[model samples]
Target: MPIEVLPVRPSFVARVIGADLTALSPAATAAIGTAIDTYSVLIVPDQHLDDDHLLTLGKTFGDVEPPRNHRVVQRLKHAELADISNLDANNRLRAADDHRRLDSLGNRLWHSDASFREVPGALSMLFAHVVPPAGGETEFADLRAAYDALDAPMQARIEGLAVEHSIFHSRGQLGHTDYTDAERAALPPVLHPLVRVHPVSKRKTLYMGSHASHIVGWPMPDGRLLLRDLMEHATQREFVYRHAWRVGDLVIWDNRCTMHRGRSYDDATHPRDLRRVTTKDLSMLQPA
Candidate 1:
């Protein structure tokens, strides 16, 4: 059966109307794969999926990970995956600025989740459990649109340019109080093309990240200026899709061609909880 997927917003989000991803037929599964390429973001509502269901859904796409040393305590479900909840009373994160809330708060800067790693996440599926009264909106930028919007000259200039990305930059954004020095040192800088060709879709996309620290061998000031300008150009409001989440809303986005961010909610006043699972990326990053 062909699954019905309708657009939620103009640019990238779609709501799967009558499909259960955990128990999909081959044809329905194929439809979802096709839908993901077309929509980039998919929202399936009201289905309370357990760890097995989550893993099953992700398996239909690719590898499911709650990789070792995963930050949150996602066990009883899947420790390897991330469990994003503000009410983790026993969590080591006592400070208000922990990266533990990346799905709802820490991801304010546009980025492909885990893009700083050797194997970045290919997709992210977040299910809202308890949403705060206000704020904590998720923002997504259409990289393909951003790339297409570029002028011919600027496009040509960045065609062959590679940008350096690092986990260090993201970790240090709020100050590196979270990671030990060894953990930080393990993740070295790696370079990837400024523009990437999506392996499956063959679509051209601008690969820019707030965590992208520099251009290889380029002076710090120049690299910073270039990266900043490129990101600004790519993240114009015209190309973004902002999702003001409701409880039980599930958002799945293609990490291959979309950059996402999270707007902060007043964590001090109210608590929000969401479960986040990021599928692994096969596109390995190598040092320039």
Candidate 2:
């Protein structure tokens, strides 16, 4: 069957059908790439994708990086391919917002993948291994729209603004979000233009991550006030989409121009498992 791309909302997501990426024709593979460029989020339903298939789909874009800690593999799955959920050492389930010790990033505000690092991610693939009866919806905001929505004066004011993004500032000494000291050491603070240029589409996008602590060289209070104001304003309802999950639902999003956050899940009461993979194709975007 030919591929079908159905938009969930005119502005944001698309439900992709008619092609199996795990074993796609050359034309179909190219089609998925084009779909990614046009729609930031592509949802595939009832895809019983195994790790191999998942890896195949990710490689269609760029190098795959998996997270490093898991009972599933020895020495870890790298930092890019991670099973994103709250499962403890014993492999028991956890609550969404609850943090035990210094482990798991399930307790964050909002972020784009790896914006704190020198080379941020280009795409994110999340597969719903399991879903709870309620909760665990993921939310995404369209940054291009956010940038376009700002008033002219505000737009001009932030055109060249830069921010210091650091994971250290986010986790601190506790270091529980699964990165070891050595791993964390490998990642250092980086600067990102508040407004970035999309490489393929040649559009401007808002570039803010949870790891962004403050604007460079700005006073703390002033930075915090401005950052908070912009974040809240950009993430307003009109510019966002919330996705409810179902078993076998796979979500692929353009990390370059989207901001995503996890909604609360009934962690303590039920088990939810989601596998995530990240892609870093810097050629798709340029530093502003």
Candidate 3:
């Protein structure tokens, strides 16, 4: 079947149809890649994918990032898939006071995946195997449009600035302080340009998010204010797409040019099991 790409938003998201994600042909792969480059988010609905199937689809884009050596013990057994759920290892709901649940609360804040890593993430694929009756929607902001919408003066002011991002800073905002000294040492903050140009599409995008602590070479107070301002501006209603998920839905997003957050859901009473596989940026694999 011929692949079809239908826009979900005027700016940057689309729904792709008529391709088997598990057994994509070269032509289908090219079409999907082009769709992704044109629309940063692609939603493929009513699809069933196991871990192996998810991994196969993820590798079509780039190197699938290994599951993080998380400081917090992981409940999921699969090393390739990140568990984005409220259940424990035995699939029981965690207590309201569970530290893992607290850690996941940070997901409510807008963030780009792996922004704090030296080699930032390129793309992320999330599959919804179970979804709640209400809420649990994921919201994505189009940073490309956000960058273009800026006034001339504002654009010039931020064009060359960089920001320092850290996992500690983002998680700290939600009162998650379980990281040990060694974990902190291993995952120190990294710097990335506030305005990034997509290597393929050649479009520029704003990269600030919850993980972005402060601007480089600026006073802490001023830097934080600027970061907050940019985040607010980028996530305005006009530049956003809110996706209401359903079971058997697969959503892929470019982390390099977007910021996303999970909406609140009734985790204690409802099950919302999702699996995620991410690919590393190609540039990260290149020799410096």
Candidate 4:
């Protein structure tokens, strides 16, 4: 049974209608894989998924990425479920000045999940348990579309370029340097091509985000400037989608061709709870 999908945009983004993620038919599952390659982002509403269910669904995509030590308390049971929320270990809203809250503020920066790693993330499945009354929407930019919009000469210039990405650099941008020495050592910088061809779709997509520190082998200042310029161009309104989250909604996005960021909400006054699981990109094991 093919899943019914409504396109949110001509180039990317769609809403999967009336499909129970927990009990997918083989045909439906294949349709979803096809949808991901075509749409890059899918919003599935009215899902009832627990941590166990989320973990199971994530495995259908690929190897689930393990949780990284951000020096924050582990609120969830599964090591694969990332605690994407404003609550503490006790399930209460965190203090406005809590270190965990401060560190999470980096999610507001446009970034592809796990781009700083040696093996970058492929798909990010985020499930909304509770959403704030206002704000807190997630925005995604279509890197394939952004890349296509580039002029021919600009495309040729960056065709063979690679970028050095670092988790420290992105967190440093927000003055949130509360990392433990062990955490710092675990998350050293890595290199990835500036433009990578999608394994399934074969479209050239820009592999950049807040984690992208600078272009490899270029002078620091020049590399930073180029990265900044590319970021500005890639995130133009024409290539972006904003998702206003609702409770029970699960959004899945392809990190291979998209960058996303969370919008601002009143963290002190309202509670916004979401959990995420990402899959590792196997294409990363091969040459990019």
Tell how far residue 246 is off in model 4, in angstroms. 0.5
Candidates 1 and 3: which is better by lDDT?
3
Looking at model 4, residue 235 earns an lDDT score of 92
lDDT of 2 at 53: 74
Q: Against the true structure, what is each candidate's TM-score?
A: 0.88, 0.87, 0.96, 0.98
Give the candidates in order of lDDT, highest first.
Answer: 4, 3, 2, 1
Two-way TM-score contest, 3 vs 4, winner? 4
Compare the candidates by lDDT and give the number of the best one.
4
Q: What C-alpha lDDT, on a 0 to 100 scale, does residue 97 get in candidate 3?
A: 87
lDDT of 2 by residue, 90-179 (tens): 567654444442444533457887777677788989888878899988999888898888999988988788898876666652354655
Model 4 agreement with the true structure over 113-226: per-residue lDDT tens digits: 999899889999999999999999999999999999999999998999989998888989999888888888998999999999999999999999999999988999999998
Best by TM-score: 4
Better of 1 and 2 by lDDT: 2
Candidate 3 TM-score versus the reference = 0.96
What overall lDDT, based on C-alpha atoms, would model 1 receive against the true structure? Answer: 0.75
- Worst lDDT run of 10 residues, candidate 2, spans 70-79
Clashes of 1: 3
Tens digits of per-residue lDDT for model 1, 124-235: 8887877889998888989988898889998897787778787668656656546666766877777777888877787888887877888777798998898889889878
Clashing pairs in 4: none
lDDT of each: 0.75, 0.76, 0.88, 0.92
